[model samples]
Target: MKMLKMLSVVFLSAMIFTACNDDNTTNGKGKASIYITDAPIDDDNVAAVIISVNSVEANGPEGWETIDEFEEPVDIDLLSYQNGEAFLLTENEMDAGTYSEVRLILNIQEKVNDQIQNEGSYIEYLDGSKEPLFVPSGGQSGYKAKGEFTIPVGGVVGVTLDFDVRKAVVKAGNSGNFILKPTIRLIANQDAAMINGHFEPDNLDSAGYNKVVAFAYENDTFTESETNEPAEGEIRFPNAVTSSVIIGGDFTLAFMKSGTYDLYFASYDENGGYVELIGSYQDVTLEAGTKLELDLELNLLN
Candidate 1:
């Protein structure tokens, strides 16, 4: 049997800009730009995951302000922006202040020939299966994320929103349908860090796999038993600082915060059907703006 290789890599780009006016006034306006990226999910059965974004908005003490709007909705294939790549969404000028919320409007429905059609969003599977994926309350109300951030005068701030596809895409029980719940985080570009390395398997060709899965746990006491499934408060699978997929023995988990974490790696078959626990390291400390490198060997038991 010829097995297909599935590798997972995801990224999100949310650039926040705050510029100083000519007079450097306290309440002056600045330029705010928005971008979109993806954290890819590796599944042999899934061929494509597409989403259409229409507009972006931000809220502050004054009121809700429009950052960027698209006359035609932008269709994005989440899997394509892998390995730390990103694309621009939109840009606009806004007053300098602390924005408390951000909103993303998606194209879930459209009016065609004087009739409301279901021309919103969909996903394609490897088995030639296609289905519509719905976003609850995302069309009319838009998806809103709340956080407090300040744009200082004479400074440019870049923020990144990491969208995790593994946790956001849900499969209905035996129904073969998928739902997009959207798991995202807003992080300051300056405070971000990365952890990357290479893994060498004993037998590369016959290993039956093409990628290795890496996970980071905040708790130092996390063990192998907890990795079999997602354990609330213990194992952070989808939102786990950065659950990276190492391709061709190389991997990089970026945008991590400064702290101590437990790192674990496992090998999976090309079709993503089989998995084996290689090993793990505990108390790995990550500093801000620093790239920490660590290498390992996958020792499979006979």
Candidate 2:
């Protein structure tokens, strides 16, 4: 896939706020800044992966508050924010307390006639292939993420929402249309780790399966016999940093929290299709500010 570079445009308003404080005991409110980042997907044919984000909402003791709202739906090409790079979505002063949920409201759009119009969020490929990216029922309510994080009085809290495109876009049966089943995770910028490696497929052609997907399951076990069962642990799909395939068949999965994780890989085809399970490494431990490297020879399922 051809890599493209795009500059981020921040839509800031004239709202004055106090600097974020690191200590929680400070008087009133703290600053919370949210960012948008992507975990790399292994699809070579896609030229752009665009999504429309309307607003960001956070739930605190004061019920729900709009942290950031876009006057118009902002179309973001996620492919540009790979490998730890991120764009600021919104920033606002929030109360100094534990915020339980953060939600993103997406505006799905479509192409009508020759002009690109807002019907809903959709994906367009380099081959001129297009698909409808549908957000499920709950997404309309908001893509709600649960976690208890404190905005220290005067201290700034940075949250990065990782959008894993590979896991989020699902093909609708034999039809060419796709569904945007968004798979997202929240990572505090300060507590993230990395995992890198090389994937060597014995007989697969590089062009056919151009993308590599790494799935991280925290505190989980995956036995070959239990492949059909839903395993436990937080599954950080393709959105983890270093999750995209690099030149020379190398892959990296970054922004992982410190824990014991089971890492699995799979081959992704040109048409946004997952070929098969490449292989997996169990009991992989990650620590803060540490990088784990593991090169693997993929085991073909068939």
Candidate 3:
């Protein structure tokens, strides 16, 4: 009789443990993962690479928010090219709740050697400051996601940030010193389709920094003529938007109506001007119920 009782007790304990685990993983509960991908968007002969998000969460509500802080220090090695990619697992999972905001936080890169690095290259600042901005050297860093979005449980949330590295320019603060990159996080909310990334620039030198310019062909003949060759020429029929400069981090035009359009960008330094042909006159058909993300990079020779 004693032996039988002992056996029964052991069986009950095992069953209890198993049930608890199942409750954590299933039953409308558990955590998600934020996957990162490094790819380049091509333009003309230049290819600019950027790291964007491709993450998923389980049993998540239509939306979620990042706590705005990291639970612990995340080690980011900025030296090796491979270090450009990173991921952090949340300490606690988002409980099974109706969340509407999806948030994320990115910590600064951990220092490897005495010297700091940004964009995998050595930097020089205006005030003779050793470290420059827009590269990972070390220090506190991060950016909040734009607005809220709705995400369903067991669903995948996809986001891609297309940037022109060669033509993309970042302005440093008044100090004009320090190495860092833009850190970002996202939150979920109702009508999540209205999210956008804000681009702001700081002035450091009187000579000025690089900027992107927006241009479109004047008439049907000009646009069709340059369909294959992305080149610069005089505008024959200038739309109300004759031209605009691409300065700071944001240099994109929203296309409510899309067709074939020729686009180009230029850079101006004290040395003079360098023209960059971003894309040829291609027929870009923008239809309803679609999000068009066409970011291109170009080389500007001074």
Candidate 4:
């Protein structure tokens, strides 16, 4: 598998592909509907995270199984799939059984005139500026989505890979080049859950703080790394499974695997950097199809 330097992101530019060979099929076939979505990013400058995926594959007992491949590279805007929204890749029958991992392959590095050319994976800023995201090369685990799923004998199994774009994307040192890391959660759609709610502060507004990023971490897993300044190639809330920007007195953390979590709100300082943890919601249990709606209040930090 290709290693991402630090974190990773998801931009599944999905297209229909033919199924695997008959040798990989079993006595019974099952259906799989794969989708991709992204967690909210706090970077206000980021307007669109466009990614181009050439194919989707799974690791099976028979070996690397092909789920689907694209005849044409599709440019998918990950930012559009926020707030629990998902983009379906394909819904086709496959070998019945369990697969340990799922990954997305980016064919951006194409040889044109015997030269490596990056196709259409880049980030668009609010100011109309753009920069291409550097996609690394390697095995089927290029995107690094981790999970275990079983395609039933005669039923459909739907899974959504939550790409935490905020974490997966980091600038390469002082080079200004953004690298797309492989950091994603492969969650069974039936067991995936989300946390969404309104948090209108009594005396706080967007202008009060530079930024308010809501993070969801496994219960009691939050450490100082979450609030402290991140390393040169990392971001705060490093331990958070997922996070979202608190906008218009509303925020959402979506596609979390079923579990107990601690939701914390951190307000950035004047420099637009993490300063302190201002608000929190502890011991929250979430399940699929159910949204944990929280009515929260923000406290002054500055």
* Alpha carbon lDDT of each predicted model: 0.62, 0.63, 0.30, 0.72
* Model 3 superposed RMSD (Cα): 18.7
TM-score of each: 0.77, 0.70, 0.34, 0.83
- For every model shown, the clashing-pair count is 5, 15, 23, 4
Least accurate 10 contiguous residues by lDDT in model 2: 6-15
Evaluate model 2: give its TM-score: 0.70
Q: Is candidate 3 or candidate 4 better by lDDT?
A: 4
lDDT per residue for candidate 1 within 1-302, as digits (tens), equals 11112122333233334455565455476555554455557576788777788788888757888777888888877666544555556656667777877778888644446554555577778887777776666676676665566655555555555556666667655555466675765555556566766666554446666667777778565654654664432223443655777777777666666788887766677686436666776677776656677665555221
Q: Scored by Cα lDDT, where does model 2 land? A: 0.63
Which parts of model 2 have CA positions greater than 4 angstroms off?
Answer: 1-27, 109-117, 136-140, 172-177, 198-213, 225-243, 267-278, 293-302
What are the per-model C-alpha RMSD values against the true structure? 7.0, 8.3, 18.7, 7.9
Q: Which stretches of model 1 miss by more than 4 angstroms?
A: 1-27, 109-118, 127-129, 173-176, 201-210, 221-239, 299-302
lDDT of 1: 0.62
Q: Is candidate 2 or candidate 4 better by TM-score?
A: 4
| Clash number for candidate 2 | 15
Predicted candidate 4 versus true structure: per-residue lDDT over 257-287, tens digit per residue: 7779988878876545666788777888876
Point out where model 4 deviates above 4 Å.
1-27, 109-115, 138-141, 201-203, 269-272, 299-302
Comparing 3 and 4 on TM-score, the stronger one: 4
